[model samples]
Target chain A: MMLISAIILIIMIVILPLETGRFLERFDKGHQNDTGMVFLSGFLLQLVLFFPVALGTMFFIRQDNFVWCTRIYLILSCIPAIAGAVCRIRKLKEKKPAAGPERKAEVYKNTGEEKNGKFRDAEKTILWAAFFIILAYQLYKAVTTAFIDGDNTFYVTQSLIAQQQGVMFTNLPYTGGPTSLDMRHALAVLPLWFAYLAKVSGIHATVLCKTVMPLFLIPFTYLVFFEIAKRLYPEEKNNIPFFLCLVAVFEMFGSVSIYTSERFFLTRTWQGKAMLGSVVIPVIILALLMIAADIRDKSNANIKTAWYLIVSAGIFSGICTSLGVAFSALLTLGGCLVIAIRDRKPKLFAMSMLACIPQAVYMVLYVILK
Target chain B: MISRLWAYLELNIETVKNYAGTGFLLLIYAAAFAYLLISEKDKAKRVIFVWIPGLTLLFFFLPPVRWMYMKYIDGSATYYRVLWLIPVAMTIAHGFTRICEGFKLIGLPVAVALIALCGGDVYHSVAGPLVIASKAQNEYHIPQEVIETADIIMANEQGHRVKAVMPLDFTSYIRQYDTDLYLAYGRELIMRPDAYDELYSMLCEDPIDVEKMREAAIPRQVSYYVFPKTSGFVKDPESCGLEKAGETKDHVIYRDPEELEYMSGISYYYFTD
Candidate 1:
């Protein structure tokens, strides 16, 4: 049962996002080949899309009973997911008649490309192996060892409460007594999402968080880093693997202090705040790179999707932690402002601010409710 | 306001120091950023590797910017997160990789050494044995004693939910395993200096007065008292009606017979409502 739930979680996080990413691939010619970006786009698409419906359902219910909210939200959110799947299937069907020769030709082209590509054979293979070993080691440690943190009193307990009681953040985690709505934490419903996963999978929330989550999060974060590497060294695909090995090593030794993102990633990867720091921030950086690359190429036609990515990242940020709103806004708007000024494109700055509407809305809600 | 900003700057520097321990990674990052700024020919890569990070660092240190951030978002404690905007590892990796690409033979080993030196072992302990990761006691990852303690209490609990006062160490994990086990006061009070509870303070005090503890627990309807065996008390708790119900490896569970009877009578009505 536990294995099944873990597999289900992996599918929900990885396979569904990949399908959604396949659907989103149509919007950008550049990112079609970048699997990391596609997965990120699909992941953000899920998050940004799921958030509003979840919030609306929460509002409609008014009592914050996460059991019903999660159930209904799960059903409703699957509409987009199913639609994305249908679109992918239809597209595949359309291509099927022509796919035989085209697929063969594409495979031949890839083989030729690989022969000419800058990715060195032996060195690239070694780097790739090292990266996988590091990833596997991290996962092994995550599953076997437990890093105790104080904040779980709130975050994990919130998931456990919602799983056990069907309520949201209505009960104070420390004492297990009824509490008034904590507007600050109420809107950041990552823990509720954990509850939803636990409820559907029939796994205890604590085990899902402590043991299962890191398996996905660590790899997912590296995916974002891999995307960044592709942007940084696009011409040198070999360098990408080396970059990942370095990132894994840095993260392994990143506990310079308790406050560093590396420390958070290693110790508290399951938490929303850690997600914001490790995953969402890096995705935002990737968005900036995508935009800058498109702009520099004067292939500004497909740049609209990058802005959408920023918007999705912004909402996804708010979904992770309320503080994520400010951080994402600062990165998106600030990075855009810099890019705009340096490149002398005022429109880019304006579009960046426009992309921040979701974040802005979340902030307004937080302030009014707070 | 100026003084506040000055204080904030000092706090920010402290945060930076803590985050950048030994400052080796930052030094490597600075060198990487500089190398990228000078040598990177790609315009798009330059925007990410050079421009965005430079501006972010400027904003991070700028007094008015720091002031606005502190005033609006959060304080200096979390200010270190702003530094996260810089792609430290990526920058260093990219720069070092590019630099090493020139000297193909020894470059990889040199880059590896520099990075390893820059980064302290995450599992390295500053104050004690370096055993950061250990086999989890249970699926919950909380202490096995906490799980045992919860099991004992749940076996003895007469009500669907019962209140207990345990040592501060167990406050966070007890309710996580079983929400029915309520704490009179919790981790929030211990972590937050402003928050205080009289019973919690009394229970934590050395040589705890049994009669006074009884006085405090009565009003809160605290049915169980879990104390470390090493804990000192002014008098035997049994003298004040708390009978030893069970014992774990590290803790002794003493149940208030009166509180249990009271809870038995009122629990259904008290809890279900």
Candidate 2:
């Protein structure tokens, strides 16, 4: 069964997301986004599309037959991602994307590109050096501390249970039976998604939850940070290294900050709460930057793509954790209010607020749900 | 109130003094944040670089917010304040960017100095403690002896999980290896007494309250009583109507004379204090 599952996962993981990302890139201006960003955005979109169905399947079927329920949940979840990739391909024939690896992530208006100089190569070398140095330094802090914290135990137990029992929200870890656990059920299942993949891939749930997320997501997090920095200084190529330098050198509050996103990224990256703070918060910041750039550049078509990105992020927030969507709404509402009142771009504000609806709905569920 | 405030101020001063290098880096972030906020033009960029860090620093100063989190939330705001590190990182980034841009041709030298300065802080504030903790975690592992004993008992159990009462110290040692079985007294926050009430003693009070645990086992499920060979607990399994089922080199597993009731379901309440 494990071998069967592993064979299926190997094909589904990369190919589907790559095709989906390439197709999704079509809606953007000349497809002028970064390759990594497009891939992650497509992956995030797939996660958002498939989560509800996977969760619904897990709930009813899990009690009767756990193994098949897990297999069924995974199989059902892959459909939308695969289908969306195909549909997007059929829709977007041959207008090539000009983003990501193809070109530098766009600068906002015409502030002009960086001047060629002897210092430029030195600056980039220093930038790449700083990136690795910071990555290693933070990873040291993250990996060493281990999951001695409270919520770490909570999510570890949940993920482990999913791997062992092939069920969700049913078995208690200490004394096994149906869980009377109540909060928002939406917040409860984020760990299960990681567990599902671990189940099929034959990786231990603990290692996936602990090592893999920080190892992978933290680097992607830097990419997200770079995109935001690029949007901030679109033409000032010198600023790219400056942005990275900031990413590396800032250790603010030090160990005094017991619960910083840095701490979460290093130690608790696997948990839903950590994902919300580290991953989703940064994505929200990136979306806000893109929205600001679109309004400034007055690109209506790009504006459409940007709004779609925000909604996709919002949907991801719902599946990732309840707090993610709530934070998304708070960030969008705050950003929209700023743009609406200050920039007098009420249309942009209105559209951004509309984009925040999925997040708002998720927040409502968090508030009203039993 | 003034005296209390003075005491609080002194304590914080001491904390800052313990690692003055971090304090200095924090000061750099603050100064840069303030200067950049005043000088920078782009409000959008400033939000990421300036206001977020500034607001978080503002959160640090607000004693009421600090107190509420300290009192009601977790015992400290330090963990929740981890979010502030983002702003702090950006603020440091902001400082580096400003210095490099200011120096122009000499920016590389300036960048080197900044990295060195921050590296010093990372050493004192983070790296020193991280090395110690990492070493401790690597060196202190559970013995293979306990793990093998657990494996033998599990293999003999005919695919059914046996409920066992043992010392709480070895509970994690057993469960760490496998989860198919139950520990009547384990490291869970929410644990209820099994039918024989063997768990109430070791967990509820410090010394083993053997008097409370001596009641005979009730029949409805499988039950086992396990103890290490080095145990100081009263070793008579017959008191609880359990017969010695098996023994390993370091441990023994005792089975109930009759069937025992199964305990299942989430332990609804947990005691923290």
DockQ of each: 0.47, 0.20
For residue B260, give model 1's deviation from the true position in Å. 2.8
Candidate 1: list runs displaced more than 4 Å.
A26-30, A62-64, A97-119, B1-11, B102-106, B125-135, B205-207, B232-239, B261-273
lDDT of each: 0.78, 0.56
Where does candidate 2 stray beyond 4 Å?
A1-15, A29-33, A58-69, A80-114, A117-119, A136-145, A181-186, A249-254, B1-26, B50-86, B102-153, B165-178, B185-200, B203-231, B236-273
At residue B270, what lDDT does model 1 achieve? 14
> Alpha-carbon error at B225 in model 1, in Å?
1.5
Q: Residues A73-108, candidate 1: write the lDDT tens digits.
A: 677656656766787778778775332222221122
Expressed as tens digits, the lDDT of each residue in B1-273 for candidate 1 is: 888778867766776788888788788888899899999988778877898899888778777777777778875457788888877877887787788763433566677777788777655523244445567777788889998988888887643677888888899888778777788889988688899888778877899887898887888888888988888999999998889989999899998877673332111101112
RMSD of each: 4.2, 6.6
Q: Could you give candidate 2's per-residue lDDT for residues A1-370 as a string of tens digits?
A: 6576546554455555655666667656444445666666666765775566555655445353335546665666566556656755675576553233544543335565535566766766766676678778766655454434434434665666667766664555553434543355534467777767677677666655655455556666677777666676566667776667566554322443343455455545677666766667667767666666566666554455556667787777677665456556655666666656656878867777788877666666566654
- Give DockQ: model 2: 0.20
Q: Write the per-residue lDDT of candidate 2 for residues B1-273, one digit (tens) a residue.
A: 766556554544443344334455556656777777787777666655655444544544445544554564346324343233245555556556665663534664465466455444322334434421232132112335445556655666654566667655555445434455665544563333433344535523434333345342233243766656655545355564666667777877667646544445232221111
